[model samples]
Target: MSKPLRVGVAGLGVVGASLARLLQRQSEALASRTGRAIVVTAVSARDRARDRGLDLNGVAFFDDPRALAGSESIDVFVELMGGADGPAYDSVKAALNSGKPVVTANKALIAKHGLELARLAEEKGLAFAFESSVAGGVPIIKTLREGLAGNSIRRIYGILNGTCNYILSKMETDGLSFEECLKEAQRLGYAEADPTFDVGGFDTAHKLAILASLAFGTAIDAEAIHVEGIETITQDDLAAADELGFRIKLLGVAERTARGVEQRVHPTMVAKSTAIAQVMGVLNAVTIDADAVGELTLVGPGAGGDATASAVAADIVDIARGVAIQPFGRPAHMLEEVERIPMQRHEGGYYVRLMVVDRPGAMAAIATRMGERKISLESIMQKGGARLARRRTDPPPAEGAPETVRVVLITHATSEQAIREALDLALADGVVTQKPQVIRIERE
Candidate 1:
């Protein structure tokens, strides 16, 4: 047998430690399959004294990740550091510069700097593997980069973040408010105290940007994506969506259109009966539309130590087996410049909620504005009658006084411009008591 492949691990966090344990347990089987033994020669983390419960006696320790990267004892560098920049970036760059293969689970770094890293790795002819970066353990990256190489992908989308999905799912299932569910998630350790990155849709946007590049053979462009969070979605909106045969999901969607590529992360209204809507809790699911392979949906655990480590180990095994492929499924130099489509030009249906004065001409004024803008309404529902039904309630509105009404309208597929125009007209005419709440709808 040939000499074993010595690997250095940086960041002994949950993922890094899990990867070390996996490598330790699976080394024998991995060796038999690859005809080369795999060993972890060194490890690095912030604290060397922390009891990680893993045997590190055989492995050398380094205080700085760059030192581990530059160490001559390892042939591969596994980066499980959890940041887009800083030491993770510095270490990965050092490893690539050292001509060692790299495997990283850092989605942010990969999403923000994947194109440049791919270029450097390609120029040096080194394996730049990040199978755990997108959708955690789903293996979607490999599925896109190699399995579907022959086909052209038209669109890809999924529930990419588990924290956001879990909160949203709890809100829908238990009728909990966003704040309440977020607090529960925090108490349960599903979310951090400051959960803006995951809850605000930035995390999903990062992963989507990476997937978009692989699917479209384009350069990584996180800034090009239009992102919207689920903070504003109320229990009323969820109930309304469910009543309309839909579920509100935070979705990362990328599609290749004639105008350009549409990359967006937002709270989307997906048909309730579709598979994507059925995905609940902290689970992740990705759907790909390809020319030859048709539609493929992959769903699984998207985060945590072992699950993510499983993907990282898979990439290490691939490297051990001598499987070297293009980072983005094409030569880095061949990646095309993606034409980013503007979000305003996106065509879709919308759900609008308006608190309107229940006077005789109020609905007429709102309808006229929508008609002028060519936004045809598919359905309208009036709520807030329960208060009026109570005999103990205050006296009804005087003859000329306007009563309040909750009006919900679902519009047919229309351009965003039409909706904006209609909203502006309605607000100007004082037909809407409050600013109209508009939520975009995605057809499954």
Candidate 2:
């Protein structure tokens, strides 16, 4: 057998601790498969006295991750310390500069500084891998970078954030309000206390940036992605989706367009029959459309220490076996610059929910506005009777506010510009009492 591959792990959080345990448990099997033993030689974290439940008896400990990165004691540096610009960034750069292979689960770092790091790795002729960065243990990165190499990828989209998915799933299934579901998610540890990063769709945008690079051979540009959160989603929208034979999910989508590769993360209406719509709770599903493979969807646990550690371990095993591949599938120098495509250029079916005054000619005014924009409605669903049907979460109506009703219009394929223009006109015309809820519909 070849010499054991020494791995130095930084950040002894849940994922880092889980990785140490996994390597120890699978040492024999991993050795047999790779012709070498994969060992955790050292680790770095804040408090050395803190117990991580891993047997670190003989393993070296470093308080500073930068020391661990450049140490001669390890052959590979695994960065679990996450942050786009701080110590995580410094330490990874140190490791790559030291001519060491690097593995990480930091999606933010990859999305923000991938091209520069990939260039460095290429200059050093080293393996730089991040399988755990995107869809946890689903191996979507490898599938796009290697498995689908022969295919021309057209689109890649998925429910990339588990926290958002869990909240949405709970809201739809339990008929709970968005606030109620979010509170439950935080209580259950599925979401952070702030929860803005996950719930606000930035996390999914980061992952989508990475996926867009791998699938389209373009550089990662997170700023180019159009993002919208589930903050505005309500039970009324969920009920309307269910009635329309659709399920609402927060999806990260990247597709080829005449303008350029369009990347977006938002609340989407997918038909209930689609594989992605069937995924609920914390699970994730990624569907890729290619010329050769058609549509391929991979579903699995999107988060958790064990699931994410499994992905990290796969990268370590590949390093043990001396497998080397460019970080983004192709050489860094060859990656094309992504052309920024504005969201207004997006063309798709839409689900528009409006709170309109319950009076004569209100519906006609809204319809006339849509007609002015050349937007055609596929179906119109009106919920409520003659009386006002106010949402339970809504604030008490004022002394003399107009009685309002919920109106949902399912529009045929139309440009985002048309939809927004129509809604703006309706809002200005006093037909819409509040801001309209517009969700893009995915027919597939």
Candidate 3:
């Protein structure tokens, strides 16, 4: 009865179309639940003739999303358009500038321009929610903003990229190579034709930047966060992780450290017993550590139109119920520019796999390099093997390039700088045949 909570949607791609269908199909139930009928009055897409599998009869359509954003018929604008800039940014900005509540699933947009947008939304006294941006349906933003509002959030971390998770999960379970699993993921639509964005860790970085802002009350700094992709994760790494009773996952971690706010996205080896370690395939799991909550882990579908739309729809319902909250869990101005802690100061256990020229004193030299810096090794594994397939085009390994041995070391907690220096020394000393394959360990 409250004016039907009028809605406008931009970008009628898979997610937009799904959201349109969902609103129509669940109209009655949503009305009863929220005590306000939710209706899709305006929709925007590039193609007007293309069938969206929905009857848009009696609804307004706009070729340009910015026009729909400025329409007076809709009270709320939902943006599913992807990209860090361009139409998505312009449309959302227009909607917020006009004092309309905007809900968007654009992680890149939020990560890159969240501070400016949040400031504008606060100034206009309107809602600028992005629950669907990070970890899809996990409701992580809500948890940090509402559930843990009473406590000091110490850290937030999780497996944020489902594509990388699927690839890694397949590699671990099926004993398949990264290439094989990646191709299969592409066939299954879990990965894009150009899987660079997902596998390269930029996608995770975008999501992490948003979360870091919400959790730590810092300005979103996607560029400052250290990003490491999963492309370097080999089958041997997976096998080694399994042998050590651990699972490898690509995690985006943000924490309030002594130095400042530290955000990073990289391949992490979590112990088998951890809750996040069990999340496999396309599922995402996020853990928030706070003073009051201790550790709360949220697990669910990380992507897909339906799952993400569920989150978007929830924000709509909250708006209908007149719920108010900050876009980043605090006033945009109050979210100060916290100093960013560089990854060099990051302290953590590490899993290192080095190809050594199986000769005497090689192992001792590695040990000495670590010992010089007082870096303690938890365990050492030696697997006898032949020369790794050193590229088909390259000449044979110098006839007798010293039969290589695989030495895997699990180090106790140490600074990233110390480990890097030790590894560099080992490589320079010619004790290592190639660069070491290092995966940071996350016991929690």
Model 1, residue 313: displacement in angstroms?
0.6
What residue pairs are clashing in model 3? none
Q: Which predicted model would earn the best TM-score?
A: 2
Tens-digit per-residue lDDT, 122-196, candidate 1? 899999999999888899999998899899999999999999999999999998889999999999888988999
Candidate 1, residue 131: the lDDT equals 93
CA lDDT, every prediction?
Answer: 0.89, 0.94, 0.90
Minimal lDDT window, size 10, model 2 = 385-394
Clash number by candidate, in order? 0, 0, 0
Inter-residue clash pairs, candidate 2:
none
Q: TM-score of every model?
A: 0.95, 0.98, 0.97
What are the root-mean-square deviations of the candidates from the true structure over C-alphas?
2.7, 1.1, 2.0
CA displacement after TM-score superposition, residue 291 of candidate 2 (Å): 0.7
Question: How far is 57's C-alpha from truth in model 2 (Å)?
Answer: 1.1
RMSD of 1: 2.7
Order the candidates by lDDT, highest first — what do you get? 2, 3, 1
Error of 3 at 421 (Å): 1.0
